[model samples]
Target: MSGKLARLQQQHDSLQQEHKALQQTKNQLNQELQSIQRTASNAIRISNERNDLRKQVADLTRNVADLRQQNRDLSNESNRDWFLIGAAVVIAGILIGLLLPHLRFQRRRNNWGAL
Candidate 1:
C-alpha cells in the first residue's frame, strides 16, 4: 500500500507540470494571434488608401483631357474668325481700287465739257 501511494503522487506531479506547459503555450499563441490581427488591419487600410489615390489620378487625367479639347476648340474658332476678317479686308480693298479710277475719269470728262 505504501508503494502504490508514492507512485500515485509522482503521476499527479507529472500531470500538473504538463498542464502548466500547455497553459504557457496557449498564452504565446494568443499573443501571436493578436499581432497578426493588427497587421491585417493595417494592410487593409493601406489598400483602401491606394485605391482612393488611383481614383483621384483617373479623375485628374479626365479633367486634363477635357481642358485640352476645350483649348483646341477655342483655337479653331479664333483661326476661323481671323480668316473671315482677312477676306473682308481684301474684298473692300479690291472694290475701292476698281471704283476710284472710274470716278476720276468721269470728273475729268465733265471738266472738259464745261471748258
Candidate 2:
C-alpha cells in the first residue's frame, strides 16, 4: 500500500509540472500573436500613407507641367510682340532715310544777266 501511494504521488507531481510548462508556452504564444497584430496594423497604415504620397506627387507633377506649358505660351506671345515692335521701328527709320531729303525745299537766289 505504501509503495502504490508513493507512485501515485510522483505521477501527480509530474503532471503538475507539465501543466505549468504548457501554461508558460501558451502565454508566450499569446504575446507573439499580439506582436504580430501590431506589426500588421503598422504595415497597413504605412501602405496607405505611401499611396497618398504617390497621389500627391502625381498631382504636383501634372501641375508643374501645366505651368510650364502656360509659361511657354506666354513667352512666345511676348517674343512676338517684341519682334513686331522692332520691325515697326526699323520701317520708320527706313522711311525717314528715303523721304526726308526729298522733302527739303530748294533755296532760290536772283542773279543778273551777263552780256
Give candidate 2 regions above 4 Å deviation.
1-4, 106-115
Expressed as tens digits, the lDDT of each residue in 1-115 for candidate 2 is 9899999999999999999999999999999999999999999999999999999999999999999999999999999999999999999999999999889787775555542
Whole-structure CA lDDT of model 2: 0.97
Among all candidates shown, the one with the greatest TM-score: 2
Candidate topping lDDT: 2
| Candidate 1 vs. true structure, TM-score | 0.74
TM-score of each: 0.74, 0.78
Give the lDDT of residue 112 in candidate 1. 62
TM-score of 2: 0.78
Q: Which parts of model 1 have CA positions greater than 4 angstroms off?
A: 105-115
